[model samples]
Target: MGSVEIIFHGAAGTVTGSCFEVRANNKTVLIDCGMFQGTRSLEALNHEQLPFDPKAISAVILTHAHLDHSGRLPYLTAQGCHAQIWMTAPTADIIEPLLLDSAKLQAADAARRNRRPDRMALPPFIPLYTGDDVTSCIGQIKETCYGAWNELGNDDGFRLWDAQHIVGSASVELKLADQRILFSGDIGGGSAIQCADVPLGGYDQIICETTYGDRTREPVLISDRREQLAQYIEEALGKNGNVLIPAFAVERTQIVLEDLVALFESKRLKPFNVFVDSPLAERVTRTTQRHRLTGYDLFSVPNIRFTHDVEESKQINSMSGVIIIAGSGMCQGGRIRHHLLHNLPNARARVLLVGYQVAGTLGAVLRDGARNVRISGHDVPVRADVKIIDSYSVHADRPALMQWIKDRGPVSGSVFLVHGEQHALSVFAQDIRKAGLAPHVVVPMLGESWSVSANHAAKRICPAREDLQVRIAPRDWTASLAALKSGLADRLRALPSDAARERVLASMTRALEDAESIRTIT
Candidate 1:
């Protein structure tokens, strides 16, 4: 029988595009099929040839419904990954609309670039799959609830625990043979406006994300932030300011709507006719209504005025003082761009940013207090008041995350960090050292794997690992592998007696005692 291996198919040194593969019992399973986002060179890596074939996968275990974690499923399934897709009920409901819209967005991007799918060098740019592909992908999904353990293949099993990032998000615990490897999907803040609790751990190899790992996102009293946002809108509305909020299509859109509704009801802000201007965002809100009957009860908020038609969306801008929440939070694309193009150059407008703005995005420029921003084809003056609130983000910041980790089960394994900026990861690495968790803070690179085994499962493989796939043909690899494989095999055979066998076994145990697995390549 063969041993298990966890391969980093995505979300390596750089964040986003989060795909990881676990191969055991000669069956392959994927965790989180997400897309990579960023600069052209970085994004191009998503389209680059994969080290492994897509069709060989047996199943996909989704962590959440966020586009970054679920976006690439359509493309992979289109390429013939005919395995059962497993996720929480809400995640399954969410994947459908999100992927269909992402496909539409890709097609839109291709059309604007005036290029055929065949001409784009971007990964999955080969038409970026179709709406049909998304439909096919959705049809294969099976739902599993949090806190349940399900067997996937052979004796391999996993427990999907609450991650609390969004509705239906989960952190996975995978059991391979006798070994336990925990893949901590994006951990969430304990106190998001919506959702609850992070995962507890008893992991041998903990693959954790650090999106906000550098420093704690200091506490911002929710009431204070909400009041600040309400006052910003009220002041802007008094001046006839068009409040343009670049909101995420998922939870953020609903939060803004509910928050605004409360403000209006409380007489904190005048009822100035708010507009939710993205069709994609509208669909997500509709889907979120289903969650109201379950664990996600935030969608039932009254007085949310969503505009589904383009004409109605355009009419929102015609009105002088209106609140517009649109998708593409970075103001990179989608309905948000159209709103920004029309309102950002005006003196009587305010932009409320309540999400992370990656570098180079229009939102980032505004956050940096830039004097002007280029929108569509013209340079627009940035006369609008730009406001940011951390209370709105769903993920836990560093301090909150540390609290969860502190309360989790014993840290008997190596802590392998994933999903954060390099500098931010470096800072967290230093912080963890101060927190006193050991077995080394391993900063894993893209495509690097470290072998982990439970204390009871640790054993010496006599044949040595051969026929292992190499991403690139390694020089001197054949000679080194041959020598090691031969030497290890010879050592096993040369143990001539029970006494010698005991000696070998004792040495092996001693070696494993101090020999924690840690491989970090930048």
Candidate 2:
């Protein structure tokens, strides 16, 4: 039996990026090459040089089409990776649009930044990768079936199992000589109406995700969730205002549409004009409809209108008492931000969040009831009601995750937990030890590595990257800066006299000067 080594390249202490490198029998393969998301400091890592050489990788196994798991594929191809990328057919279909949209967004953002007057003298910003890179990467992808084992050269192979997280999501089982290891791509909770339950199996070693390992959610039935949505929409419309839903263009948007259709068909919801304002969401919805998995077209409903152009999307802001669904579930970018800028200060409007928001994102800020937010460099007051439906989260909760782990049980070697915050993974590790679910459990840090053998415990080799330790914090300086700006503004406005406001501003200016002096002296 050949020895196997695994490296934790991403998604170790933080929840967003999801890359891993596996080496066996003089061959190397990458499990995923996801992008780092959330805070600006974290996203900045996306432009840094990859720790490993892309040309050395033999093949890449993609688990799904989500940006966090597949965003860096184009970047890899741009860096000279020529290996065949393997994924399920559905993933292949969805990623083409997702990656292309991502490229466009990046290009647009770079152009916007470069256009700033302050940035005119600085080096022009460039996108991480272009549309051409995405096309090149897509050309290398080969579709594979769920149950069949495909050879990876040198007598090694892998098989795919349904992860049920999203359309075409899969958990991979890798076979190398006498050893087998499994990678649990994001597992789906039982809330998805179109996906089946996750399948289970045993392996010598397992690498699992702990996205929601610290908490167990209350069970929410489909009917109950739909009723909750109906209530929120009705209440918002009753106040003579529109409802804005910022959703992910992939599974979350489709799920919301399906529930909306169900509510209308059951006469639980009144027919209101609903605008699907995101072009990417529209494309994804069309693709889903083509699959015919839901037995009916979700976009065929008479009340739902898809806006195909920028002018049509802009028209949505002028309408009242209607429902608008947009992309970028986290409120990071896209048409949702424009809608938020327009409606956040409207006392009668409502913002409904339907997915997990990373800790440093604008969505998290609004979900936590921030009264003022900065969107597109403009400060906006939060007069609209912001609500969240936790039941809509696609990730499995603690109980479901534990149950899935137990089902994949009798693991003879070790279980490595990744893709979660530090606290979540730590608590999960403690629980795993209490239940004796595996012989060994590891909560790996970013840049750490382990060697696996059939009869021995997994051995740690690579040390964690000290530089990355700061990047794992839930909130970074960007969030802090925003809060500071908002707080300063509010305090200045609340002062009883103009002199008081001037005094506060003068004090802040003096502090900044003193800090600058200290830096110069040091």
Prediction 2 global C-alpha lDDT? 0.88
lDDT tens readout by residue for model 1, 432-491 = 779875455666666665554443232222221222112111213332333344346446
lDDT of 2 at 21: 95
Q: Tell me, by TM-score, which candidate is best.
A: 2
| lDDT value, residue 150 of candidate 1 | 84
How do the residues 144-224 of candidate 2 rate in per-residue lDDT, one tens digit apiece? 978777998777988888787888889888887667899999999653222235345567899999999999999999899
How far in Å is the alpha carbon of 236 misplaced in model 2? 0.6
Query: For every model shown, what is its TM-score relative to the native structure?
Result: 0.79, 0.95
Displacement of residue 386 (Cα, Å) in model 2 is 0.7
lDDT of each: 0.71, 0.88
Best by lDDT: 2
Candidate 2 residue-wise lDDT at 481? 81
